[model samples]
Target: MDSQIRSVLPKTDFNRRSFVVTSIAAGFALAVLPVGAATITTDTTGLVAGEVKIPVKGGEIPAYRALPVNGGNNLPVVLIVHEIFGVHEHIQDLCRRYAKLGYYAIAPDLYARQGDVKKLTSIQDIVTKVVSKTPDEQVLLDLDATVAYLAGKANTDKLAVTGFCWGGRIVWLYAAHNPKVKAAGAWYGRLVGDTDPNHPENPIDIASKLKVPVLGLYGGKDQGIPLASIEQMRRVLKEAGNPSEIVVYSQAEHGFNADYRPSYNPEAAKDAQQKLLAWFKKYGVA
Candidate 1:
């Protein structure tokens, strides 16, 4: 094993196992069961979409990938990090949406080694058993592994990354972690919070170190992420002279881009999507 992977490995049974969730689930997570009627589904027509295994330090983890069927190997690459729900149908759909726009999109199962959140019935349980146990270092390594897996398949030189909720927070850390990334779009990701050994720093802690421009799309009504924290992050970015920017939708709540949730805001989601694409294009990820 690489010394770096060994250093970040959680001193738990996880180190003894190859993987917990070997494959991506087929539908929405049970925690979000009874998916809302407003859920949006993207068709895979004219697209090559399905599951594939990405090799990591220990073993291979599954991921959902989508790209235009006729798109050559030089297609722009976009890494789609999934929410806490894991790489369920929604995340897969997002990959398809990106493929329709001529980008090779892939969402790796980051929680595969920790546990499967899709089987858990409650969000609290999922967080306690999986999310909380997942080390930030491990997640970043897995994402790096995912990118490495794209080496000959996509144009990594035009790499971009975007994520939602838990994955969104990762966007900030990843932008700082990987200099090859051209742009990033973070939607409703936490900016600050208590840290542990595994999570040594929050997004705010590295705001000044960001070399890749990030477009943060936030929901003003998200009680979990206070307006104060957003302002704090904004102030830090401004003081650092970072090109990163944040947009707040006053009427939208957390998970506003989640079409399958009651908190979904169509207007905000649409606008945020446009901004995300434009941000990527402006930063040369298009």
Candidate 2:
């Protein structure tokens, strides 16, 4: 598919009300294997963890969800979108980490509707075959549906979104799309890009329209995301009323938070996590 992805939600009869529950009963795990770092994997001993099929446009897309041991009403929900590599092991572990933090987190395989990037050998192939073909509008709608699913299960009033690499840009778009969101944390996502009619805009373009508070965590050494682009994005955000903040760690590079990656910076990751917690709490997502 050379062109941007066509709308997939409406075609699937996208239903959020009963989607999460229907997925809750389904089996999941071993969708992908470990590749790098001592990727943190939290036990689901006292928690609800498994695979679920989110009802999308026509067919249901598979995803992994994790929640607290003692489930209650209206728990804060975090939509954990994945990097360009897709919703593999690292992404699933992230959902568990958020679950440990008391938030019901879900990592939907957004790429499932397209193709599994994990099966592809090269990142370049993954980008061209999967990522590029993905439409921005589709991602926003899927995430919105995920929120609605969680809202039905827990309180979504304190909703927050977090994404890594490719997902980081999505966090920005979601914050702009949903005013109900309390906050968002974007990790080293791209700032600018070419526009298409199907893929209408980029994060920098949406800075002025952003409605919710967002914390952008970036790396100065990142090859793909230059400091200048980050600065330009900052300028745009400052010009807007939201004043969303972006932090660039001089020593870090892209995927610094992913322990499995060579560029993972322990200090930077810990500090960023602290700030992310504080940001969420300040914005009421805690």
Candidate 3:
């Protein structure tokens, strides 16, 4: 059912790149006023940073692509899945950050087919309209399409995926769904959640079936994801003989990696970013 659902409808709306491209990375997203209050902003100088259209099943979809200035040779690819807030500003910066590390980073606006989340005022409204309606099957296919696009541009031999918040959950789902990824780093994604027709499964539910080694970074004090549940997921993965691992920052809360949000933790965020780099390298994605 999961595989068949998306094969039929390959939705693509890549032409709508309302977000302008900037060579200077400072203050890219104007909507985010007083930027860097909590979220970290990455500069895009000396980088091929701009919006590019990825050819999905139906049509082209707009997405932010970034790579090092001298990344002419075939470079490793890293798919940066955006958070629930959608691919507004911070997620694009993340792609730039990965590009600085010499990895071809691409973050597709997966919610483009449904609607634009940037126009929404409240996070709840974005969640209700965009996040909830997005099917896991579609997300995986979209990521695959992005990978295929990158493959044409550079060396996608070593593929890696990283996501934050809502994207964190997708990290697990994508790792389980695609056998091509070398590694995945999930940032504070929910392990357990209610199931419905629109959303059929959660990360915890599929822990035993994961083929790729996943490194989960969580916050101990996260208000949404409890510590108990993370522990349960760890147990499930270990029992299933899965090589994946989970790491929780004891003093951090949710959005620790989000330097733009109030919940951002500088110490934990730095450490986690290092961990992500190491995990990717250890698994040969770097």
Candidate 4:
């Protein structure tokens, strides 16, 4: 198969709601494994952690949902957005970690309708075959469906969102789209990108329109996302009088929170997690 994928379908004919990634993938992505011992795997004891179907417009997509078994319906909801690699073990384990902390955490496989990037070998191939084919409008609709599925049980008013890498950009997009969101944490998502029909706006473009507070965690040394772009986003938020903020860890590189990667920075990840929880708590999402 040609890894250099052209546009898979016409923009008008693409209906993300009609398609779904039905299976919750197992283990780490083939491209990233062996994930090694550094990756954190939170056990499901005292929690319900597994696949659940979230019904969309025409079908259902599989998502990994984790929440305390004993916690009642009042728990805060946290949407876990996966990296470009998709919702594999590390993303599932992160959901479990949040569940242990008393939040109902769910990581929906955002690329379900597109090809699975986990099966692809290289980052560029994965992006071309899967990520590039996914549309921002589709992502927001699927996420809205996920949230609506938990409407009666989860506290939407206290809703928060967090994402890693590709998902980080989504966190910002969701915050701008959903008025119910209280807080969000974006981890190393690209701050700027070219405008296309699939991805019409980057985080920088939406910063002024953010409906909720977002805490952006970025690496000063990240080669993919430049500090200049981050600074530009900060200036936009400041000018808009938005409460959103961006923090740059001087010693960290991209994917610092991904313990499965060589780019993981323990100090930055830990500190970022602490800041994330605190930001959520302060904004009523905790």
Candidate 5:
């Protein structure tokens, strides 16, 4: 574990609220609120699904947690980092899907400290005012808090992480930050970008420091993330002797896994999900 991660972990378990976002946001993020018929909704009939609050420094952040109703503490943990849209229905559904597979999946609202992107109508505004303001340090601490919160409740030792879009970028950083993470699945996240005051590094920058193997799923046609960057990331990983792999779907575009969005690609999304499950099991995250 890194020194910073060591410092943020809860020294002792403390009492905390059950859930925060009691009622999930009505629909998809306002920026891309269009309702597509392909949206996938996972049920919670066999699992405990709903909001859960994670205690942080001075306050608490809300998260969606789903675990098997009968697994108790035997379930593996999968931290589902949400897209820039926040912990909306899609994210919660993902938690349920993981729970159905005997994994305790939790998706914390990483942007809680900055602002809620779900309510904002413009994607650019959400990026500028909310996502941009959220410090990487804060996001990492909140995730650590979430893991600490589930210390005794879930099989934390078999930990895996998966994130989409903006959260995809975080999957890389989290794997680098926490050595205990068994594996990570990053979906169409930017591999390289200009550094700012809050975010000083990209996935390419820390490829050499990654202790956890990352299964990076990308789309060659992704407009926001150029193919050159992905190639660069591959070069960095190889040079660093890292075993990470990046799989690019030549025909898919960014947000291909987002079932509710126009960019959603059912074929690619299904293949990626299967690949993710296999990757986790291969890396001992099961």
Candidate 6:
């Protein structure tokens, strides 16, 4: 951890007995072992970056926050929802990236109440034990709590949200849930899926109801998310007269922006990031 990171971290004894996943893990999750050679690491130089506690419903949840060292109050806020692997190194690095770009970025451990997925070695096991059991309502509430935590620290009115994988799906729901959000960038999130009590709606279900403009970045070759579903979402948005747009990278796969994964696509990731920033700026979130 950088000295700046240590300085900003809450001065509290974060032990396992006190909270689930008391602190952010050092590296990638066990499930994504053998870190890719292209893994990107963002240093906390000239930035206040580290772990902080977000007061939620039942209790507090651990969250990683990063922002400019000299940035005063009312900075633009960007909420980064994590992948199924949790808020590991990649997500932390992403926060730093946003901080470098003059945004107050935060990524809360939405799975803190359930279980730590970092220790789990298999993807399926993590999904069954942690992800599957997590309720969408709880996740949204936690996000609201996170924003509440920001109160005077950042400008909530200029709020923007972006997520990946599991978190990507959440970006859509959150936009519909919170009208204060100015813009959102969803990367490779599922558009359609079976409805259940925990997850009663997908992005497709709420396409027509979305008031906030959203930019959906999808991978054409993503096996998990079919192109047809993306088309359906686009149709719904268009029919509803929504300003949202979906862009597909024909050569990219899922997680193309995750530099620490095998699915990472440098070209696509770079372009998508540029588009996300432009989207945020276009919608007055910058």
lDDT of 4 by residue, 1-286 (tens): 1112234444433453555457897798988977757888789999988999888766788899999999888899999999988888899999999999999999888888877777887877887777777888888998999999888877777899999888998999999999888899999988776756677778888889988999999999898888899899999999999999899999999899999988999999999999999999999887
Query: Tens-digit lDDT track for model 1 on 1-286?
Result: 0001112324343344569989876899998979899999999899999999998877889999999999989999999989878899999999999999999999999999989889999877877677877888888988999999999999999999999998889999999999899999999999988776667788999999999999999999997889999999999999999999999999999999999999999999999999999999998988
lDDT ranking, high to low: 1, 6, 4, 5, 3, 2
Q: 275, model 5: CA deviation in Å?
A: 1.0
Better of 1 and 5 by TM-score: 1
Ranking of models by TM-score: 1, 4, 6, 5, 3, 2
lDDT of 3 by residue, 159-276 (tens): 9999988889889999989998999999988888776554578899889999999999999988888888999999999999998989999999888887876678899999988988
In model 4, which range of ten residues has the least summed lDDT?
1-10
- TM-score for each prediction? 0.95, 0.87, 0.88, 0.94, 0.91, 0.93
Pick the lDDT winner. Answer: 1
The lDDT for every candidate, in the order shown, is 0.89, 0.76, 0.79, 0.86, 0.83, 0.87
After superposition on all CA atoms, how large is the RMSD of candidate 2?
4.9
lDDT of 2 by residue, 119-206 (tens): 6766667666666666677788877767666657888887888999889988988888989988899999877866665457778888
Considering every candidate listed, which one attains the maximal TM-score? 1
- Whole-structure CA lDDT of model 4: 0.86
lDDT of 5 by residue, 111-155 (tens): 776677788887777776667766777788889999999988998
lDDT of 3 at 250: 96
Q: What is candidate 1's CA lDDT for residue 40?
A: 94
